[model samples]
Each structure stands twice: as C-alpha cells, then as structure tokens.
Target chain A: MTMKKIVLMALAACLALGTTGVYASQADDINALRHYFKKKFPTVPFKEFANGSYALSADKRINWESMRDFPPFEDHVAKGEALWNKKFKNGNSFATCLGNDVTKVRNRFPHWNAKDKKVETLEGNIVACQKANGEKPFGLKKGNIAYLSAYIASQANGQKVNVVVPDDKDAQAAYEAGKQFFYAKRGQLNLSCADCHVYSAGMYARGNLLSPVMGHTTHFPVWRGKWAKKKGDGFGTLHRRYGGCNKQVRAKPFKAQGKEYSNMEFFHASMSNGLTIDAPDYRE
Target chain B: MKKMTLKVALLAAMMATSGFAVAMDEDSYRAEHKAATEALNKAKKVGGEWRDSRWKKSTAVKVDGKKMSYLHAAEAYAAKGDYKNAMKYAGIAKFEGEMGYQQAMDQKNAGPRH
Candidate 1:
C-alpha cells in the first residue's frame, strides 16, 4: 500500500478503537451504578412493586383532628404565644425584635446568609434574633426556642417555604452536602435515606408506607399516633428527624441542632421550597 | 426468474429479523409477567391468611364445638403438609375465634415453613 493510504487506514483504525473503548467505559459505569443501587436497596423489588403500589397498608393514614386537640406542643404553642406577647427581661418581646408583627416575620425566615453563604433555618434565625437583642438563645431541644420557633413557623401555616441559596460556590457546596447526606448510606441497615424515601416510598416496612420525604418538612410539630399520649406535640423537627434517621441506620444519633443535621435540614427544607407549610400534622 | 429470486431474498431477510424480534418480545413479556404473578401470589397468600384469621376472631360466638376447633385442626393439618385442609380449617377457625385470638390464628395460618 502507498504510505499515505497506510497512514489514513491506521488513523481510522485508531479512531474506531478509541470510540469502542469510550463506549465500553460508559457501559461499565452504568452497570456499576445499577449494581450499587441493587446491593444497597436489596429489599426493594422494583419490578414486583411497580411505582406507587409498593406500600399500601390499612392503618398508616393519620387522623388530623385527633392531633390538634391535645397537649405538650399545644401547651408549648400557648407558651410561645405568651412569649410573643410578653415583654422580655429588657421590656422587649420577640415581637419588638421584628416590628411587633410575629405573623409576617416567620415567613421571612430561613433566609440565605450572605456571609455564611448557606441557607440558615428558622431556628438559626431565632438564635440570631435572641443574640441581637442581648438574650440567651433557647435550646434547640425540647425547650422554649424550639417551641416558640415551631409556633412562629406555624403562624406562616399557609405560607410557602422560600429559602434562597445565593448563586455562589459556598451556597452550591452547602446544597450538595445536604443532598449527599440524604443519599449517603448510614446505620446498621446500610441503607441511605433514598432507599426508603425514594426507592421504597409508598411501600410497607412492617406496617407503614414509607412516605416520600419530598414536601415532608411542610408538616412540622407533627402529632405522631404511636406517641399519641404526648398529644399535639411536635414529633419531628429537622434535628429530631435527623436523630431518628440515625437511629434507623444504627448509628448514634447526632446532637440536636448540630452542623451535620443543620446542613441536612437546610437541604431538606430547600427541597420543599415552594410547598405550603403543613405544620402540626398527624402521623402513625 | 431474477425478480423471483429478489423477492425470495427480501422475504428471507424480513422473516429473519421479524422472527428474532418476536421471540425477544415474547421472552421479555414472559419474564415480566412471571415476576409480577409471583409477587401477586405471595401478597395474596399472606393477605388471605390475615383476613381468614380476622374473620374467625370476629365471629367466635357462632361455633359450639368442644371438639378441636377449626383453628386447632388447621394447625394439625398444616403440620402434615396438607395445605388444602389446612387452608379450609384456618378459614373456619378464623370465623370462630375470639377478637384477641385473631393474631394467634394468623400466626398459625402462616404455616410452619414461612
């Protein structure tokens, strides 16, 4: 063969081989992802369960009326209302912190902190409010701040979640970290949040339909049926739910209101960005 | 003769491709159907036992036997691998057991192996 023709043929062969290699690598990556998902979520028999038909049980539905007419949280809300109206040690109520109108203040919260470059939740905002007013911060656990913030958030019941992550690198990183926390596997079950909420959602585990975590945050201060004796008490906040997720995974639950959970809550709340609040929901 | 040969060649090509496609389609359908049916049967079997026990417990006052109740008979039948009678007696036991006994009947009706 002529030298020019031989060179052209060699080049063509190399291109074909290179294309094949690229395609092979792509196929391998896809297969790896499939294998990882299958191993991680072995209990989810996707083909058999189909979509939406996986977790239909008779008793998982919550009776909303039973939740509202009860105790601890309801009482807490009353306390919060008093606090809202009561003057602080400085003769200033929380109402004085944001123009004496608690209703409009709650919806404006969970805002993007430009310096921190992350979405700070309502709880964080409350702490900031306390600090700016020279008051001690309420504990994130079963305490005044938790109750007051919940009650305050409840005021914006019909208001949509409106967290705005700034279009910056730090904001992006925080958002990604939150997403990772959701999908990353933890606990003795070696299961990720997505395994139950995304893959096996609507499917029964024991007797409950695994609810989709999407729009879940809308309902806060939930009255859980299993713990109904507490009555009107809020069972899940971002931190509380994080602890529950950790327990399910068999890992020691994180400290209430810690950074890991805060970031997770930021991401989780952001997911329900436009969904209206469904606070104080009832759940089994 | 040339036209006839061309027609035969086209027919052979079409038949080869169509046959392969049809076979693949059928195999895929069968695999999916089998998986679905297997899942359905499993769920139905579980549901059936639960329902039977629930029914028996809800209707306990109707039975008058001092002899082994259908629940006991169902347990015995299940032990012998006689699912037909086991299922029958389980249904009857469910219809004759007390309200609190439904859970026990359900466990019994599940049979030993599962």
Candidate 2:
C-alpha cells in the first residue's frame, strides 16, 4: 500500500477507537445509575425512577415578567435604583464609570477584558467601578451589591446579551477555559456538565427537565424555589448559579465570586449572547 | 390438626427471624464484607489519584453496583485524596440515597409478602 493510504488507515483506526471509548463510558454511566436505583429500591422499576430523579418538573420553568412584581427581589431592585442614584464616597455615582446612562449599562457589560485575559461579567465590572472610585468593593456574593447587580442586569431585560469575544489569544484562552470548566466532569456521580445539560437535557431528573445550557443566562435574578424560603423572594445571580451547578454535579462548589466562577459566568453568559434577559423568573 | 398447627407456628417463627436477620446492623455486616466491595464503594465517593480535576470523580463510576451506597464511594474517594468528589458523593448518599432507602423500606413493610 502507498504511504498515504497507510496514514489514512491509521487515522481511521484512531477515530474508531475514540468513538468506542466514548460509547463505553456512556454505557457504563447508565449501568451504574441503574444499579444505584435498583439497590436503593429493588422493587422500583429502574427505567421509570432513573429519569424521574433528574428530570425537570413542570414547576421549574420560568415565567419572567410575573416574577418582577415579587419582593425582596423587587425590593432589592428598588434598593438598587436607590443605590444607582446614590453617589459614591468620592461624590460620584456609577454613572461616572462611563458617560452612558446608567439604565443602559447592563446591555454593554460582561465585555472582554484584554488585561485580565477573560470576559468580565457585569457584576465584576460594577465592582471595578466601585474600586476605581476608591469605594469599598461590594462582596460579590452578599449584601446590597448582589441585589443591585441583579437589578442593573434586569434593566437590560429586553435587550440582548452582546458580549463579544475578541479574536485575541487572551479572550480566546478565557473562552476555552470557560468551556473546559463547563464540560469537565466532577462529583461522585463522575458526571460532566455536558452529561446532563447537553446529553440528557429534556430528560427528567427528579421531576425537573435538564434545561439545555444554550440560553440559560438569558434570565437573571431568577427566583429559585430552593432559595425562596431563605431570601424571601430571593434572587440568584450568575455566580450563585454557577455555584449551584457545581453543587448539583457534586463538585466542591466554588466561592460565589471567585475567578473560576467568573470565568464560568463569562462563558455561560456569552453562550446566551443573542438572547434577551428574562430576570427574576421562578424555578424549582 | 396439632401437627399442622405446630408446622404453621414454626413457619411463622422462621419468617419473623428472617426479617430480623436481614435487618441486623448494616454497618457491622458491611465492615465484615469483602474488601473489594468496600474499596469500590470508597473509590466511588472519592475519586482515585487522577490529577485532572475533570477525572476527580472517575473512580466513582466503578461503584455502579446497586449494593454500594454513595457513602462507600465517598469513603473510597476520600481515602484517595479526592475530597471534593468524596464530599459530593457523601452528601448524595446521606440525602438522596438515604431517602430512597427509607422509601423502599416503607414500601416493603406495606407490601404483602408470600
């Protein structure tokens, strides 16, 4: 055989091997889940219960506008409005960050930062503004800062997410890192984010349909049932959502406002770039 | 008639004893069980030493058997220094697995057994 033909054959063999490995891993995962279900409830049929645990129930879906009137998230929004109008310790409001109107800020945010080698979420940008003004940076996970951030993002509710990943290597690297984090497997289930969000999406896991991550960040300040009791009309930011996903996957969740999470938020928000915001939606 | 009644009583006693035997302390029995079963369970919880953080929970895939609890996998992963996955599995085992086990027990108790 010619040298070219041999090379092609070798490549084909490698591809076939790679395909088989992926299939075997998926099959193994399914079998393991089946066995887990069986051992826990021997009488419960595996096929029925397996999908039930992870499935998205009807209640988990979002109704964005309806939630806007709900309070403390609404109350938080009111507070954010107050904060936006309030001047910094430097006697200037966030309006000084850029000459643009404060109302339109969220749409332009989560922009690429060449200096940081990553995309900055709107919240991060806001904190930067506070820091630049010589004011104390608001804790990303807590207090009025998070609420105000969510409120600001909500102002762009009808506007589309338009974060641009520059062609430069730094932006590209951050995007790739974010992608890797999204697909990387963690937790005791040995499951990757793709395992459920991409592969098993639309399948039920405990009465919740695994939503495709495609347009996930289109919504913000979502009213999660899990947090409703605690926050009293609580709102979850992009960072908090990232933490929740990690917890669900059984990985040690990252801090709500850390670099890893920010990178993840950057990628997640970017994925929904064209979609409009749907803030304060209800979810199970 | 007496002979038949005695036989019935013996059968009833056997059934009662069997249930108790099965219900005997699970922890003690598990401790005495085969090492592979225990190891597999532990490994399932804490991922073995695969450096890739992505591979942190890979060992958990081994405990696919129903007989093993998430706790077993967590223990195994923890032993192997995969604390993140170990803790994750441990939480699942404690919450979801336990709830499932209890539900199963409830169903069994409610069901008619021949």
Candidate 3:
C-alpha cells in the first residue's frame, strides 16, 4: 500500500480503538477489582471485605465485632418488619407486590427496568410498590425508606449479591454511566470514588480508614455512628452512603434513587456479584 | 537643604501622578467592586453544582487559612474602604470563580469512562 494510504488507515484504526475504551466486560471488572484488593490486602480473607473498614483495621474490627453483637439497627429492623407486614388501606400489603416472597426480594432490586428506561433501586421500588398499592410512597433520604430498606435487606442475609446488567443498549448505557460517575473527578476536592476506594484503600484520611471498593455493595442499610447524633441508630441505604461519600469529597451529591445514583448502584452492585449479602451492617 | 527640597518635590510629583497610591478614587472603587461583583455572580452561577443545599454555600475549602469565596471578601474590603485590596481580591475572586464555573460546566454532562 502507498505510505499515505497506510498512514491514513493507521490513524483511523487508532481513533476507533481509543474511542471504544477496551470494553471490559462486567465479569472482567469484577475479577480485576477482586484481584486488586487481594493484592493490596493479601492477608485479609476475600469474603471479609464485606465487613468494610473492619476487614482491614484491627481496632475497627474489634469495635465492629462488639457493635455487631448488640446490633443497634435491631430496632430499625423491627420497625421495618412491622411496616413490611402492615396492610395498606386497600386490605393489601407490600407482600402482595413481591408475590409474598419477601425473603429473597432484596436480591432482585436495583434491577434494570426496560419500560421505565432506568435503574430501579430497592428503595425506589419499595416506594413504587407502595404508591401502586394505594399507599403513600416512603421518603427517599431516610426515615421510612431507611426502615423499609433495613427490613428488606435483613431478609436476605447470607444470600450472594446477584446484580445483573442486561444486554440491552439502554441497560449498558446506564451501567456505563454509573461506572463513569464512580470514576469521574468532581467537586473542589477533585477526587473520584475510585481515588479513595480503589487507589487509597487502607490509607488514613482525617483519622478515618478508607475501605477497598470491592464488596462495598455487599453490605447495605448500614448503621453509621456518625449519623447517630442527628438520627438515632443512623440507618441508611447504599445510595445514601454514595451521596455522603460525594459530599465528603466536597462534590455536590445527586439525590438518592435519582437517575445518577440508580445507575451508580447498578455498576457498584454488579461488582459484588458473588459476595454474600450482609445488610444492616455497621460502620464508624 | 537641597536634598530635602528634592525629596519634597519628588513626593509632590508622585502624589500628582499616582494620587497617593493608597487612596483609590470613588468612581474607580465602585467600578472595581462592580467587576468583582459580576465575577462573583458567575462563580455563584457555576458553583451551584458543588454547593451544599443544606448549608446553602459553595463547597470550596479554605485556602491559606482563608475561604476562597471572593464575593464576600470583596464586599467586606469595599465596605472598609480598602478599594486597592478590594480590587486585588476581586481579581483573585474572578479568577477562582471563572475556573470553578468552567470546571462545573466541563463535568456536568460528562459520562464516558476514558
């Protein structure tokens, strides 16, 4: 081929390859993230990462073990159970919407909704279910939603995370959007979610231990001590934690269960595919 | 005696040309403050993305032990009749504000993973 034609072809090929982003599969990312954590903290058991900061720091583990023994979220879980079982004014219950199988329902959440063209989080789905059943939707940030999420997640203890991203273009777009949000740098701090969770895991930041990104999705409906002062027991969903992390980095947080967060949850949850669910987890 | 006369003459000449340097003109102060206010407005417009709704303020951290928020500092300096300092701070504020606004715009619609 002529040199001019060869150079033009090479340039076109480079542009196409660069724009396509190597296109790692969900499984590829999951394995790579697990391997990254394994290499980082080889001594810690793979499954123990689900315990969050406790999995790394000895002091945190001791405190977390004691906290887990009493489990301050017990009261919230009980309230959630009560809410779950409570009947709507129409004589139907949330149980009716989930086909009466509440035990495994949490695993099915944050699913891709083809018709709605968005990710449907467990918290959002619960509210949608309530609204559909003639009941008032639970608030998104905390309170009823936290209580409800606590109860639902409690039901699925020991079940492995089974988040899936379907083959649809929209589903792929959403999952990609979420992954982008997780890695994108923003705020005055100019830190991405990956900066701490991926690169700086196990490092101390302002006296707090940073946990690895792997298995972050394994636990949800956390009982955080920081929130205890303002909110008794301080139960919150994964998306709420996402917002808090964004704010911690000085970035403005998107609303919980909004399109941004729902998509982020989709990508984040898929990373914890085989990790056992340990909802109602505790954290400092 | 000649040295003292030259010093006084030079002082008078400096005053005539630069208006004592420290004493900024009223119209100039107003204009400087107005420009700073305009820059502050741009920063505010772009800063909403990083602002904390609960606190209703920019998420910008303190720089050199002082918050980088230029508008308030500019206003305070203007109120104290420190127009020279006000203008200087206003310029800094304008620079930070424009950078902040640009950063917000650049990332607002970005979603690719590259």
Highest TM-score scorer:
3
What are the C-alpha RMSDs, in order, of all predicted structures?
A: 25.4, 16.5, 8.3
Per-residue lDDT of model 2, residues A1-284, tens digit only: 99999999988998888852442232243344345434544654422222222223434323322443453466777777787878988798877874457658777766677876667667777788898999888876545665777667667677766666666767656665665566666553555666776557567778666765545666565656677677544566768777667667655566665666776666666655555665544555
Instruction: Provide the TM-score of chain A alone for each candidate, in the order shown.
Output: 0.70, 0.72, 0.90
Higher-lDDT candidate of 2 and 3: 3
Please identify model 3 stretches exceeding 4 Å from their true place: A1-22, B1-48, B52-97, B100-114
Which candidate do you rate higher for DockQ, 2 or 3?
A: 3
Q: What level of docking quality does candidate 2 show?
A: incorrect
* Residue A8 alpha-carbon offset, candidate 2, angstroms: 28
lDDT, model 2, position A156: 69
The lDDT-based order of candidates, best leading, equals 3, 2, 1
Backbone steric clashes in candidate 2, count: 28
What local lDDT does model 3 show for residue A217? Answer: 79
By TM-score, the better pick of 1 and 3 is: 3
True contacts kept of 3: 0.27
Using lDDT as the measure, name the better of candidate 1 and candidate 3: 3
Write the residue-wise lDDT of candidate 1 on A1-284 in tens digits.
Answer: 89999999988998987852442232242234345534645665422221122223333322334344553367666766776776667876677666566668666655556686656776676667688778888766445765676677678787776655556666656655666666665433546666786667667788666865545677665545555455424454557666666666543355666556666676666655556775555556
Stretch of 10 with least lDDT, candidate 3 chain A: A19-28
- After superposition, candidate 1 runs with Cα above 4 Å error: A1-59, A65-73, A96-99, A226-236, B1-114
- The number of clashing residue pairs in model 1 is 8
Docking level for model 1: incorrect
